[model samples]
Target: MNDGLNPAWLRAFVAVCDTGSFTRAAASLDLTQAAVSQQVQRLEAECGPLLIRRTRKASLTPAGVKVLAYARDMEEAHARLRLALADDDPHVGQISVASPGSIGLLLYPRLLALQAAHPGLSVSYRAAPTADIIAAVLASRAELGIVTHRPDDERLRTELFAHESLCLVVPAQMDDVSWPALVRLGYIDHPDGMDMGRRLLARVHPGQRIDQLPVRGFTNQIGAILDPVAHGIGFAVLPRFAVQAYPRRQAIRVVDTAPQVIDSLWLVTRAEWPLSASAAWALERLREHDWLAGADAPASWPAHDNG
Candidate 1:
């Protein structure tokens, strides 16, 4: 916009589009919700045509969609400029990383160790889908990415680090690991959109009704799935790491079946750009994880190979 609108507002507008929630946008920009809303409003005032719809959740107005494409380009260019400047001065630099919530969650604890191992290293974290992580790291928006899937691009170096696999989580006293019982009781599904959960269900029971599970509730959040299951209400198919991290894990029992649901975890970085000391040190520390060093045999997770 040659209208001399603030670049900060433009950046905030783009983050809102990416996150689809003002609250998440606020978190992404490290700003208050009101602040983000005001920036968007300021941008809209310059446009004066209701750029954003501002629905109950989040929706882009017709004009909002039109501008988002270009806005994203601008935001990316700004990041590149910032990185170029930071490269000139090593004293102030940033490393942005994108990861799915599961592996992303575990990686941070290890990242803390990495940070402790090195001082004056600034790290930024973003929770994003697999494809976005691949794209971001490839584009140099992020120097490195901790993702579950491997990128096919030869320009990026990918290493299998740690894995978080699905384990059958049932109540501590519930000894019934029978498929029939699980089928009858309706598996408490965690709609995390992860492949392992779906694949394991297919392996154990093929040609079965997937939608109903007879009658079960679905939750996108892992905690929602684990809480009810841990209380003996129902069983859940979850990553071992997730089960172990559950608040009341002692009340639950893990059934790591022979054909485990394992998704390979990978570390990806652009080959063209050599990692800085901070990033290189972090990568080395990440490689030290014993869990990532080993791969679990998930019956059939061929689809995970695509990314």
Candidate 2:
């Protein structure tokens, strides 16, 4: 019964709610703070005062909360409309995806090739942590999320993508060494390195008394972590995707002494909505793309253990 409630106003309100701050919402929407605030006020005038109160964070009044869901529904409907109509036009649809850095690196080139083929398809891609990727999908900010972990939430659906092998990498100049000797070499820790190191040691050394290994260097960036290790600063545990095509891969050797570890990749989306045609097309290509196509499986690659 709300007449003339502009879609722009609804969009602005949804942006603020999603970001939890007018300033951030304005930034995300590329609108000025005053413009965003004006849209909220305009929306409230049409709907009889939507926001109830404001403190450290924006809290939607009961009316605002009700409106929020409707607003998102409208937004999704509009996006799907564009996608459905875009099929005939080719250039009218947009596809957004969220993924982790290494997977993003692996797929970005392929995605570009896909885009080139479609000419009309536009892509919005972001690389973030696994949790953030899932949040993006749940919030409907991304049409798909390519992730390493399969979330257990009932609201999400997942499809298996691939299995990435994990291996221990050392400076090529370093000789084959034992656990304690490797520990003496120190560690170049990335975000996942510490946990991977702990597991690797447990699997290889069995009952070794080591509580923790010394950390020589640290970086969160996937590709950046390898340079220090290649320079002999320390050793690292990394996925094959991160190490295989590394520019300096030849400078580092993949150690085969440790048992092969594997990480599963998954494609996730909200269960509330079906995939748009554009999303489905891209997902098929992503699944079919040979991620490990040309790359040589390391000689030390171990067979899967049924136990």
Best by TM-score: 2
Error of 1 at 297 (Å): 5.9
Q: Predicted candidate 2: what Cα RMSD to the true structure? A: 12.8
Number of clashes recorded per candidate: 3, 1
Q: Model 2: how far is 31 from its true place, Å?
A: 38
> Over the stretch 271-295, how does candidate 1's per-residue lDDT look in tens digits?
8867865566566666766645334
lDDT of each: 0.69, 0.78
Question: Model 2, which residues run further than 4 Å from truth?
Answer: 1-92, 209-211, 293-307
